[model samples]
Target chain A: MRTLYHLALSPQSRLIRLVLGEKRMEVHLRAEPVWERRDEFLAINPAGEVPVLVEDDGSTIAGSQAIAEYLEECDDTIPLLPGTIADRAEIRRLVSWFDRKFDREVTDLLVGEKVMKRFLGIGEPSSSAIRAGHANLQIHLAYIAWLAERRTWLAGDKFSLADLAAAAHLSCVDYLGDVPWDHAPEAKEWYARVKSRPAFRSLLADAVPGLRPVGHYADLDF
Target chain B: MRTLYHLALSPQSRLIRLVLGEKRMEVHLRAEPVWERRDEFLAINPAGEVPVLVEDDGSTIAGSQAIAEYLEECDDTIPLLPGTIADRAEIRRLVSWFDRKFDREVTDLLVGEKVMKRFLGIGEPSSSAIRAGHANLQIHLAYIAWLAERRTWLAGDKFSLADLAAAAHLSCVDYLGDVPWDHAPEAKEWYARVKSRPAFRSLLADAVPGLRPVGHYADLDF
Candidate 1:
């Protein structure tokens, strides 16, 4: 058995958890409040970011993508990533988009707009930034919808890490009711497939104390 | 021959250019003004970002990382990236550090203070953000120097993608005389080695019209 040190509410942590759950490997989920910065946790990861995995060999893996790749290599039986070179590139691209662009333009924006004010002690939300974030989301969501319509999964027919990355960020946005699911049936369906899996149960149950959940936060149908 | 859509001033685009040069692959370099969008550029990359490589097969690869991976697949002799899984993960983590973390903290601040103000017709710059960016750079360069002292290259012996990622963003920051090169001699030596390459030649010549070049902009040994 391995151990995963991560924040309960983080999409990346949950994504990694889902992958491990799918593989039926036991991973002790240890909560690490990265923002609070425990000294031991900082030593494990100088970046102080979560989704850090301690493997059986005592080697530590930080960064969700790195951890996911390490796991895929540890056991290739249930490949969460693609095999061929081109397939791998495509999967990496999609994973990066959700991790970078979607995370920046969508997830980052939503979190900053709807969440960061209370967290940062920055007086009241910046309405201009929030509006800009929403506008950016509109564009990103459209592009995602277009991508979803063309493929069964995000990168291709097989379920890959790309889907997990997307679901992770989208899940957070969804929790805030910030995602425009009605406008993107394709994206919605894609998420539904990811959501229905038993592995997603832990992710869906997560809650942050002061930040109240949206009306449909726990509703499976929503 | 592949065609690379690049902005000469952009380090990400320059890194791809460097790789292409190292591989001796003939790539038609199209110097695009990314800020002012064009239809053709949009057709190639939905994100409207630079370093889009249009492969000979007419398939386009967007994202510097994705484009770099696609190019690596085409040719491996030069080996711009690591081969082993663990090493590659390390390389990718470092690459992400500069591309994401540095971008958000250092580059964004400097660019906002130096570049964005000019772009938006905002006079002068925010003195506070520039000071903050400088303070942040002091810390980042120290880390780079620390890492350089321990390894032959950023990730390890091989000059992997991590080098290009660091140089790309740093080069942009350097253009504004933001890099405290004298503060980190090891990092300075690394930069000199990287900048001296034929691939970096084009990058060194970039000039943002209204902004005067940093006094030592193209001084190779400096």
Candidate 2:
């Protein structure tokens, strides 16, 4: 069986998990405390980041994008990046948008301050960062609403990694009850559709020990 | 001819430029002052970032990774992501390592502070950030030297996108004359090899209007 080293609140880790579930691939999940910088884990991924996948043959694939591409190459039966070259480019562009831009502006601000800080014993969460996170979340959610209104899914007709990448970050933020879903109903509706998917089951059930998810986090109709 | 919207010092933009050059694709480079947040550019890329490639047909691909992957799919004649699935994963891992990690620690600090700040007219460059950037650069250079000593290229025997991504970031920092290449001879040797490639010529020749590159930035043998 394949194994995945991941963190509960890590959007990148959750993105891979969703990708695996969507692909119908079974993976043994192992929680890795990346902050400790474990030597053994570092040996597998020099980046010292989570969501590193180790195959049965001991082949290690690090980084979410790398793993996603590797999986797409290995088995394209359920392509998360489907369509023509242009279509695929749009999907990847959205994926990068969420992974990099969203992560920096919202996820890192909220999750890094709220969850990661507590786990790492870093100190109190900065209210300023949390405030900024909420403010930025509104802008992103509005963007999501715009995309949702235009396309069936985030990228296009099909449900793709773009949606997963987005939901991954939003889920992490949603876990903290930070997302103002009510204010952006269109984005909320799209997210509700994503939430009902079978692949999203495990993520909704994720409890980071001391940090319990918000009241409506697991609600499929959220 | 294809068109690429880019910033002079953006590592992401430079990565795509090198990728296009490697694939023997001719592109008309257009410098986009992303700080302006032009509504037209935002429509092409909601993220409003650089390295957005527009094809002759007006099909647009945004983001460095998306553009790189699209280029590879369009033409594999000079594949930058060569080899097996595992090998490709390794290459992508290194590419991400430099694109995300290296950029965050070094390029963003050095270039963002030194170049972007001046261009944006936000404020003066922080000496603290430049100090941290220099410190981080040494660690990354040492890591590069370690990898260079072990493999022919950063990812493996083949010179892949990993090398291009690393070089893209280092070249930006080098333009500021901040890279302490003398401290890491092996990394310097590896960079020299990348710098001498025909694909690197355009980048070497680039001179921002107000700022000049280091004396050795364009030199083949330094």
List model 2 lDDT by residue over B118-215, tens digit each.
87889999999989998998999999999999999999999999999999999999999999999999999999999999999999999999899999
Question: Chain B alone, TM-score of each model?
Answer: 0.90, 0.98
Per-candidate TM-score against the hidden true structure: 0.90, 0.98
- Over the true interface, candidate 1 deviates by an RMSD, in Å, of 2.1
Q: In order, how many clashes per candidate?
A: 0, 0
Distance from true location, Cα of A22 in model 2, Å: 0.5
DockQ of each: 0.47, 0.93
Native-to-model Cα distance after best TM-score fit, residue B89 in candidate 2, in Å: 0.4
| lDDT digits (tens) for residues A1-222 of candidate 2 | 999999989999999999999999999999999989999999999889988999999999999999999999999999999999889999999999999999999998999998898878889999999889889999999999999999999999999999999999999999988888999999999999999989999999899887789999999976
What is the C-alpha lDDT profile of model 1 across B1-222, one tens digit per residue?
778998756667877887787777888988877767788898878677887888788877787777777778778888876667777777767877787778877887897668866765668988888888889888889988988999988888988888888888888898888888998999999888888877777678888777766887788988
Residue pair clashes in candidate 2: none
In model 1, what is the error at residue A32, expressed in angstroms? 1.8
For model 1, what is the C-alpha lDDT against the true structure? 0.79
